[model samples]
Target: MYCPFCSHIEDKVIDSRLSKEGDVIRRRRECFNCKQRFTTYERVGEIFPMVIKKDGRRERFNREKIFNGMKRACEKRPVSIDVLETVVGDIEKKIQEIGESEIPSHIIGKELMNQLQKLDHVAYVRFASVYKEFKDISEFMSEIKSLAPQSVVSYEQNPSKTIDGVPL
Candidate 1:
């Protein structure tokens, strides 16, 4: 690494440490020529996969875009920022686990809808209204209705009940 003090190309690493989660390396280095010390962080290059849109356009995957869409859907809702961040992280992890360099936009939308549906009904309806392109009230109502439980045998039998139909 080049030294900031004397612009020397030679440097010795005085200390090295792994950051939280071990995704990056933190290194403290000393310039050989100026005796100045500096810290640097090294991380693996993130090769984001490409997203294929429904309109046949290809673009790089962006976390900001996903977060913005989620934020809009979550507006006027009780969802917390931490929850949103975790959802994003989980989505990214799933996409990476697939090991494919390209994925359809609709697939990502489906994943988002699944997450929003579990997070908040209002947010789920809001997100689905846009993602599913509801042409009328009937479609919207049907989407929401599917989320409601028709009958629960007994609250005691169903020890775990959740708003999104998931067993808590």
Candidate 2:
């Protein structure tokens, strides 16, 4: 595997494991040239269906697009990178498992919101604000209040509290 940092072609697998319920292999690679470490995931390449946008336009599915959005919502929060990864993986897997040639963008957005809701309330609100396009502070505060108890529960229980740390 090529090292992502140095672009070195030669590398050794320092670790390997299954990810996203064993659908993919997550590998930790160490570059022989620069000794830099990176990760790679191997999965059965499937032809994902085109995502039909709300505007009635069709586009190819891109997991990175969702990941970037999730990252933004999760920014400056206790959310962990691994949690974002897992959420993205779950969304992708759900789409692929449906055995369809096309999927709606709304469904993808809902799935993202669902995953984010369970992961972090703050992140969920951040994402929802943008995804739902709140018009005023009331709308934003409603979302925040809706998330309060759950956020408190999560905060107290998991003080180390990283988004990528636990699926909950």
Q: Over all chains combined, what TM-score does candidate 1 have? A: 0.62
The global C-alpha lDDT for each of the candidates, from Candidate 1 onward, is: 0.73, 0.75
Show model 1 residue runs off by greater than 4 Å. Answer: 1-46, 150-168
What is the C-alpha local distance difference test score of candidate 2?
A: 0.75
Off by over 4 Å in 2: 1-46, 148-168
lDDT of 2 by residue, 1-168 (tens): 667888889876655555556456676777999998888877634446778998999887766689899999999999887667667767876777766777778778877887888798778888999999899999888878877787657655765642322222
* Candidate with maximal lDDT: 2
RMSD of 2: 10.1
How does model 2 score by TM-score? Answer: 0.61
All candidates: TM-score: 0.62, 0.61
